[model samples]
Target chain A: MSNVLANILGASPVMPLEKHIDVACRCAEQLAPLFAAANRGDWGAAEKAAADIEALEHEADDLKKEIRLHLPKSLFMPVPRQDLLELLLVQDRIANRARDIAGLVMIRRIQMPASIADDFLDFVDRVIDAAKQARKSVRELDELFTAGFRGAEVDLVAGMIEELDRIETDTDARQFELGKALFEIEATLNPVDAVFLHRVIELTGDVADMAERVGRRLELLLSD
Target chain B: MEAQIVYIGLAAAFGLFMAWGIGANDVANAMATSVGSKALTIKQAILVAAVFEFLGAVLAGGAVTSTIRKGIVDADLLSGSPELLVYGMLASLLAAGTWLLIASHRGWPVSTTHSIVGAIVGFAAVGIGMEAVKWDQVGTIVASWVVSPLTAGFIAFLLYQSVLWLVLQHEDPLARAKRWVPVYIFFAAFTITLVTILKGLKHVGLEISVRDSYLLAVAIATGIAAVGAYFIRQIEPDPKAEKEQHFHTVERVFGVLMVITACSMAFAHGSNDVANAIGPLAAVVSVAHTGAVSAQSALPLWVLMLGGMGIVIGLASFGRHVIATVGRKITQLTPSRGFAAELAAATTIVIASGTGLPVSTTHTLVGAVLGVGLARGIEAIDLRVVARVFVSWVVTIPAGAILAILFFFVFKSVLP
Candidate 1:
């Protein structure tokens, strides 16, 4: 059974789901280059990061489309069809939000203020943490399914999801503080840069928000 | 003697034509999943179908052939004029074959079983009067039209659920699936062999009592299960693949199971569908040779073989169109899902064959697939296709009946 080759085109929901998680992480990875370019005012590097993020997001979108098109109108599955679709929607949105942030970085062209740079990076790090936790929970899904969504493993994944929510919650408070700091420094900074930077901050936060949603989706899936 | 030879030859030809239609259209319903799932290539599917359909028919075809010949029409009434019965039988075969050809040309998914049964009833009602038709048994056969697919569906639903509960739902699915593979194969073998032995082998003249058949079935099942375990034991999980493609390893296990069950499905199809072609041919041959008709006639091996040959030829000649249609429809068959549908269809068909019911393999397969859909996989199934299949079933009986009635008059008038 193990050595046997599956049809390269075999129909399973696992492939798209796995790809969605992978691309979400890849989108998150682009944040480093995106932020580096923004800080250095290297528009060239920032443009590349933004384009790559958009491309990865589209690729994930293609995978999602393939899954939807190939998913039969009727099938005998262990999970509800709607549940699987909703899970994929959140997973794809994670990448889409990351792409949006990359787009914002390119559009705003705002250099990070030297005073708030460290705090902003810390805030981005927490958002990525929440995103990673979401991806981690998605990965644990295959394991949970094999475990019949029961026993210690189910509880273990639920714990991980709870941790993701907590991380997202913590990031929210930090983001609010950062927003206040940007307003406080508005007189010293270019007013346009301050406004766009706030937009960039919110978009960056969305990636984590989408990831938390995915975690919650999985938690709901296994409660049955 | 020359006249008798000519009559026999003509009857045999019409029989072959009907068998070919069954092989062309009906056998594809069973083999489609194997090809669609990539468990067997098209060539491999043809080879498996040819060999197993032959084996199934030669081994177990007698049961349904008996039903086809005597169960619908009263041979006792025809005993006074055996030649008329012979002509009537030949007409039914030709009419059924004609209807099949027409249906195929138009791309209609009609059942071979319905056409043949309708042909028999039509000939009996018009040629020998309505009293010659066994109305009570006719009711039972009609009821089975609805019952067969539902039974197949119920079985498929249970099998798919069991696979989920026993294997896919486990904490370590690949490992758990490995443990369950032999168990699944063991049941496939057990049920296939049990039905074949208990009901099918009587056609081959190897009549085992119930106890002996059960014992033989168990032994055969165990041997096949042991072999399945050997091939399965050789597989080692690919850690890299497991990481990249979750459940790819588990799906591969089901691939092997799909192959095993595909063989059983071909065998089941052969046992039941072979009778559709040869039952009337045998009745015609016996009357031509002995110049007498009896309620019970032995199904000669050569007659059964002729039906087998006709099916193989039909598959070789006309199977492509139906196979293509099936391949297109069967889009997303992971190995376990395909296995669930195949196992259920085969089990139901074989059981029906043993009971001397000429159930439609296509109908039962549709039912089995719907069962898989009902279990939470409905997004992958098209209800429109299922609805179309039901409509085709309704059309098949009357179409064949009208054609058979017309052919009966033509044969009788020309012969006299």
Candidate 2:
């Protein structure tokens, strides 16, 4: 009956935001299997993983759009709507970067160098860990809102963001090492293959970078 | 005598219609919070609302009914022509009931209290004379319309903030919730019980001194809280659900608190809103029975009973669908937050009912919800709906007044 009390409550974005990050992290997760398949020189398995990544990336995009559409200008929330919109953008990028990495590998048919394969897969796994950690951090959003973005909940999320930062730093270090290893064998590899491999490493590292930015966006909400 | 019977019959029918409308629409807002929070199922919410709303109307609805019956209009001015008073009240009831039906159909957020008060003020000042209205009492009623919501908001803010600090923010929130929820339960029960004792019991012909009222309230509240604690203790944490949502078990504990608040909310709604349904009927009944405007006569218990029964009938017939609709839409209000809003609004309304002030229960509730939003407890609140509520608040008075004026002239010529 057009109840005023019911209308006064705008749809809550907390659960949806949590769900979006979960999808983004799962998309980033697909990179691990995609890279592993490529490292084993199994083109068919790698393509399947790439397709999975593509599907999840599309899902994340849809979720992001849905969250934005619900978050109209009239909504009064505890955190700034701008900050949440920014956070959603950064979270979506994890899936976007995962898709980009898989797209590049599939287009170039880049075979892993024998010397760098083991280290490269490790780097990929660590980057995915960063995305997972970012999910863990953003998962605290509902609790943070419940606590009014204060007290022990803030500290708990702060601790999570700190761990997220550490994982990102670890991804950075691994990316540096993978770059150095790729350079030593660049001459033996085709010149174009060598260049694209470095590009892929950089793109892979951007996953963690986007994940780190999720933490930063959440931090902005925390500070406010 | 035949004309008096006609007036009484018309007034009863109109009052029952008004009461039924309130039961159908207004009761939903009072019960939706509990249903939305999952603290009470729809069936349970209805049953609870039925019982408590009836009790509230019968036991605590007198003061506000008296205010609406005689406080708003200056009865002395109409002593010469008591039939005019009957015509005006009959018109006010019809006007308010008609306005509510129109507003409900249009899906506008209008208050029954505002409409009735507006209707009474309209007929008295216009149909009779400008000085025939009790402007000071009207002023107080208008002031309470503003003050009740703000007061409820402030209380809700504080209550939710305390919940955050005491329970949700703790290192072990489940343990904290278990330990502290009963105390909150005690407060909720205490405030409602105390207010009802102080203000409502006298209407039932039972008066307790202030000292004994406090002691009796404390005792009753303690028993309710003890029963609440036992239920809270029985809630076992679902480890799997807890992994998915950390507050799962804690909210279950707050579920017990929400149920208590829900009852208070029903009681509060019945106490104040029954007056809107029955106030005019009481006026017409008195005038028709005595054939004189006598301020000294006591209010008959049957009028309150008739109002209570009308509301229950309304709830049975139409409130079911409205409650389900509202409950589905407000899923964001978990028990912890819903209790704060309900408790604050219930306390404010019961207090207003005690003081004989006719405040809008829906507006007070909107205020409480905004208070929760202010404390950062709610995830999202639409300021647009809130703005619309204010607009309707300002517009309802004139809409009801114009309608009442039309009905007043119609009744003057048609009625013997």
Query: For every model shown, what is its TM-score relative to the native structure?
Result: 0.86, 0.98
Q: For model 2, how big is the CA root-mean-square deviation?
A: 1.4
| Residue-level lDDT tens digits of model 1 in B1-416 | 77668779888999988888787777777787788777788888889999999988877677788888788888788878887787788888888888878886776767889999998998899888999999998888889889988998898888877877777665566777778888888899889888888776766667889898888878888888788778777777778766422466887777778888989999999988888888888888887888788755577778988898988997888775566557655655557777887899889888888888898887887787778766543224544445667788999998989899898899888874
- List model 2 lDDT by residue over B91-205, tens digit each: 9999999999999898889999999999999999899999999998999999999999999999999999999989988888888999999999999999999999999999999
lDDT (CA) per prediction: 0.79, 0.93
Best by TM-score: 2
Q: Residue A59 in candidate 2 has what lDDT?
A: 95
How badly does each model clash, as a count of residue pairs?
Answer: 18, 0
DockQ for candidate 1: 0.17
- What's model 1's lDDT at A146? 43
- For candidate 2, the per-residue lDDT at B151 reads 98
- Fnat, model 1, is 0.13
Using DockQ as the measure, the top candidate is 2
Which segments of candidate 1 are over 4 A away from where they belong?
A: A1-31, A55-92, A95-99, A118-167, A173-177, A180-184, B1-6, B41-43, B104-107, B243-246, B316-331, B377-379, B414-416
